[model samples]
Target: MDLAIVILNWNGKSWLEKFLPNVIEHSDESVIYVIDNASTDDSISFIETNFPNVSIVQNKTNFGFAGGYNEGLKNIQHEFYCLLNSDVEVTENWITPVAILFKHDSNIAAIQPKILDYNKKTHFEFAGAGGGLIDNLGFPYCRGRVFENIEKDNGQYNDETEIFWASGCCFFVRSKDFWTQNGFDARFFAHQEEIDLCWRLKNSNKKIFYTGKSTVYHVGGGTLNKQSPQKTFLNIRNNFSMILKNSPISTLLWLLPFRLVLDAFAGIYFGYQNGISHFWAVIRAHFSFYKQIPETIKLRQKSQISKFYQEKWLVFKNFL
Candidate 1:
């Protein structure tokens, strides 16, 4: 098959049972594979019995999102690969636009479809609302989403356009480009790894894009709860590592410190709103980021674009 729709699973049997049939019905002619990340649940057995046509890739241990995909996808040879989340309900013709876009532009390394909330179909999803963008300070957001403020899907982002990053929830990428960058940085474990890969692709002059023609509804936080302090920790730590590896030294000098200051204030606010665990999560994220600095610096590419951000003061403008 030219395309492979690979779903990484970890004890998400109910999600597969609910959404996999929809994916099968809507996705035509594409080979589907469920990459099981050492799931202890009956997820693998259930897929085997219910969907005999779908392929299953079993990992020895749970490698988290980043490593799970990297490990599972090594053998699946296809021109294009869709790293789909198990919780997403796809629409018909979801693959056509993305495939056409990739064919027309060899430079287009990655693409994301219009993702709406599964619960609130009228509103864009939080993971990737109307495509992903980063600010001057390396804070990631989407066109239809800024911080926690999600915009209603009013056909405002219907045009296909270049994007800074493609959400991992429903990411499409040329197989060659994916392998060129060595898939994803497994060290990331989960959050912001897609952004890191897209940034690296951009640095290499490859393009990332979003298409409104195709749409999917994401049941966000299937594996990790959005409110979990562990999620916050991963988001914060991985984001810092991403910025450090991709940003030019000139920009990184000022941006890193500024983001650190902003994060301190954010931590306090998180504590006041969510709980003390979130505040401590931010602190722990910083410490983890510091420890990873040596390894992150070594992974930096030879060349990086100076102008990467889509906006300035995005967090302040959104929240303040």
Candidate 2:
């Protein structure tokens, strides 16, 4: 099947420069497309000169991760699509193994190869986190990280199975399924969008998976620095947004009180230290859900096409 390898960049001229060559070295069954979110850094001219073979969509304004990837994916007319972070490196022709996984399981909607970070050999890239998982409260953590056990990638994790969510970093998915699911929620301009999408798939009885044989090294948070407050704000906001949009009624009912209490405490504590910016960040998160209700309702209605409720939903949710 033809695949579109969709990569998004925002002022990442250098990352694209180095990454595109290595990516082509590892996989060639797909056409590479870059969605450049208005960068003052000459990313457009650089790509035009250095990577003449690749297709680049130059956006006039920065549209964080979700919007940028959505913009790129919309233009791709391939049998399948690979949403990749420009800063990551694939270890091989990862799509072959992923296609095999898809062939074996019709229920699999998303399949993310095992992701590791190498700049620091011991630390797992928190973005994908050895296959994404979630707690009861719509709180996403990973196998390699919880409150934090984040182990060194010493080749310890090899088992592959159905998972709660696939990492968005370098995920491969059926193009039709992606568009049918309405792609990433534009409301979630950045973080937790994959988990939200996978949760919808699971709610519809589709499986999300992580495969061990395929591997890639992620640079992690290429567009926005992890420590940036904007990142924190988006993460917090999207968590609430996902809870509002995707979780089954029962799952949402169970998670609400627990998440509220914890996040409120976090908001208070962080506010005291970082002053009002940290405080307002999470408060805005809580309110962002309200701001997004019009689209949220439409999303919920669209996602109900093949909803899997009660037992199946619980069984899938219980996997975490």
Candidate 3:
């Protein structure tokens, strides 16, 4: 099958230079695409000078992760689409194993290769370890990771399994499935967008799988550095929106009061400590997303929400 590998980058020149050859060699004959989020650095010019064969999408402003990739997804001319980071390198066998799965089933909407730590080599990298998994609360996590905890890259989680979502850092989705979900929500600006997309696909009975046979070496959080407080804020705020925008009526109402109390306290605390403005902004964003809930509700299919929840045993993250 033809694969369109889309790498979203922002000032990732050095990392791309080192990993592009690996991607090119391993993903032979595949279309290599570099979507730059208008890095202040000369990333676009560098790509033109250094890797003339790769396709380039140069945005004038930094579009963050979702926007950069959404642009790439819209333009890809292939059956399969991969949203890989510029900081990742693939194994020689990477694409082979994952592609073979599509041969067996038409329902599999996406697949993520095992992600390993580039520096450690022997340990797992948490970014998108085995696709992506999350609790019902929109707290996006991974099968090999939970909360801030990340597992080692040992051969321990070497078996294939059904995944909640494919990692945004390095994962693939069927081109049609992606377009059907309208790709990642650009409002996400950065995090938790993958889970939202996957949940929508779940509504269509599409399976997102984790393929262990394929692997990629990743320097996790290379783009936005997920540890920054800005990153923290996005993760928290977006998690709230993801849950509000995607969860079914029963699920949302079930988690409402507690989610409300937590957000209320969180807003107050952040406001008191950070400032009233920051706190009020969070509350406003929350209400804004809540207001739009109806729009998403109308788009959902397979209201038997239990099908998605039952597999997880009715789990939701306690993190808020």
**lDDT winner:** 1
TM values, all candidates: 0.94, 0.89, 0.84
Candidate 2 lDDT by residue in tens digits, 185-224: 8778888888888888887778988887788888876777
Candidate 1 lDDT, 1-320, residue by residue in tens: 39999999999999999999999998899999999999999998999999999999999999999999999999798999999999999998899999889888889999999999999999999999999999888999999999999999999999999999999999999999999999899999999999999999998999999999999999998889999999999999999999899988778889999998899899999999999999999999999999999999889886653243323346557877
| Predicted structure 3: clash tally | 4
- Candidate models: Cα lDDT each: 0.93, 0.79, 0.77
Instruction: Please give, for residues 41-159, the per-residue lDDT of candidate 3 as tens digits.
Output: 87788889988999997776777888778875666678898888888888886888788888788899988888888988876777887557766554677766776677876677677
Considering summed lDDT, which 10 consecutive residues are worst modelled in model 1? 304-313
Clash pairs for candidate 2: none
Count of steric clashes across candidates, in order? 0, 0, 4
State candidate 2's TM-score: 0.89
Of the pair 2 and 3, which is ahead by lDDT?
A: 2
**What is the model-wide C-alpha lDDT for candidate 1?**
0.93
Better structure of 1 and 2 per TM-score: 1
